[model samples]
Target: MPFVEMSISLEGVSILLKIMVTGKVVAVGNFSRYIEDSRKEAIELISKLLGVTIEEAEEEVNITKGLTVRKAWLKTWWSPNWKSKPFTYPPVQCTERAFLLYLLSYTLFVDKSGSRVSIALLKLLENLDDVGNYAWGATALAYLYCQLGSATRVEVLQIVRYLTLFEGWVYEHFELRFATSNAKYMDQLQPRVSRWIQKHETVNVGDKLA
Candidate 1:
């Protein structure tokens, strides 16, 4: 049996590499329900990886949706590779899990800010590179900041600091795999600060420097 690490990119949004135990497949029935369960499991896995308490992980992932397994094939979101082969699993690989957390964090921060959720997100996708788990971490951090906005309440700051520290720790994996220039990525991500600043034109510098 070959223990293969396969790196797959999906629709330019995110990249996921799985270490598959080949010939070891888990057959699933009721795609929708299974898919939802898969997502929850993915979050739990990441939370475990990040060493977050169970309570904290639950607090972070508040809104979980239920899916119908019979109708799973109908929705591409449930399928990691919508255009490619169908996955027997809900496709909750490490990369996908990271991306989900990232988006959830972003939504929290952005909504916390004054910008309407729609407009804030409309800006996030611009120049967003959908590569590597680190990119997902960056995106998630951005979202957390958006959810936190300029006024970082004590509790929100704690979450932001915890996640940002985790981001620094996990970034090495992506650096080894992708080997893209850090300077370049930093440059790309800097634009997000401008967007944040725009929202807080009159705010103090200390408050907005996330």
Candidate 2:
């Protein structure tokens, strides 16, 4: 059966969803007492305007990633390719593939019991270019990595490639500007940075120091 994926966008936030309708709303409901009841009424109105039965109108409701808006789905007969149609925040091929690899590696190898993995993930995110809700996605990834800390070096290295790809594409190729605007900020941090260097602390990636 064909499906209608209803996506809603508000102030650049978008969510694609699937929903199933339970029943028609009969009353002009108050929003305060029971918000769900009011929502049902609103959906019924939408269903009538769209020329579909209420049952056919709600198939799934999903809060898609990188979005702040609400979306409800009304499945309808349409082309099978509808699902393949790209959303606004479509995944970039290289970046998405790299991220997937990293996730798999984390699942297989990372040991999840300490703050080390969390710190690493946070550092990776802090270094990435913030674009198109990507920071949010990265934050989510960081949380996952932090939570799943049983990962081995092999898996982490695999994921790091994706992170490096992001760095190269978003940082190097795009020539994006850093948020730092003041020379004073750099000057103030220089001494602390010197101390950090003197401490001889360095990140070791695989067998090499980064």
Candidate 3:
């Protein structure tokens, strides 16, 4: 396995994040020679070999290295190519995950400035509902939230609570159902049955629900 070690610093605080690539390497022809190259070169080589954008290739490598059997299975299940020969995952799912990972990777490894972090967070909020629909989506969203600095995490949580009041909807997933619940005093969610209201209102409003 090959790995990349990266450091991100914000204010006076520093954090480290790792990108690991797992699996045996079966290099053919001249490709094997580049294995000993520097990390930057190695990343470029991997990008070219995989025929993916550099960011996409990097995300794929990290996901492949870190993904468990269950996650891989869910990704495969959500993929549009599930019925195709050789199997292919859904591009939309891939793109969404890649974007999330990119945001996380950039924030954790490249820049941790306030403006950059805010932009990334807004992007997450904007796509919050769509990302929640994917298998393991809520988990991914939570992971992204955890990556933020302490204060930012609290702010994001508050924003998520506000969004849940309007945009949240119930799903088959227990995590999501539990998240969007709104029973108030009964250990339910906030705003008192917001998910129920959102569902009914969505039905009544047709496509106007936002």
TM-scores for all predictions: 0.19, 0.19, 0.20
Per residue, candidate 3 scores C-alpha lDDT tens digits across 1-210 of 111222211210111111111222212133223233333343454344223457854564344342111223233334546445565444453445434433433322222331222112222323445433322222222343454434375445432211221232222122454344334423122212223333432211101111
Per-candidate Cα RMSD to the true structure, in Å, reads 19.5, 21.0, 17.4
Instruction: Kindly give the stretch of ten consecutive residues in candidate 1 with the minimal lDDT sum.
Output: 11-20
List the global CA lDDT of all models: 0.31, 0.26, 0.30
Over 65-177, each residue of candidate 2 has an lDDT whose tens digit, in order, gives 11111111211112224345542322243233223223323332233321112111222222223222232323323433443353454555333211321221222123335
Better of 2 and 3 by TM-score: 3
Identify the candidate with maximal TM-score: 3
lDDT of 1 by residue, 1-210 (tens): 111222211211111111111221222233333355654663454344333455644544443232211112223334457647554433344334334334433332323222211212212332223222123333433444454464466554433322322232233233444323333323233321222112112211111112
Which runs of model 2 end up more than 4 angstroms from their true locations?
A: 1-34, 58-77, 80-210
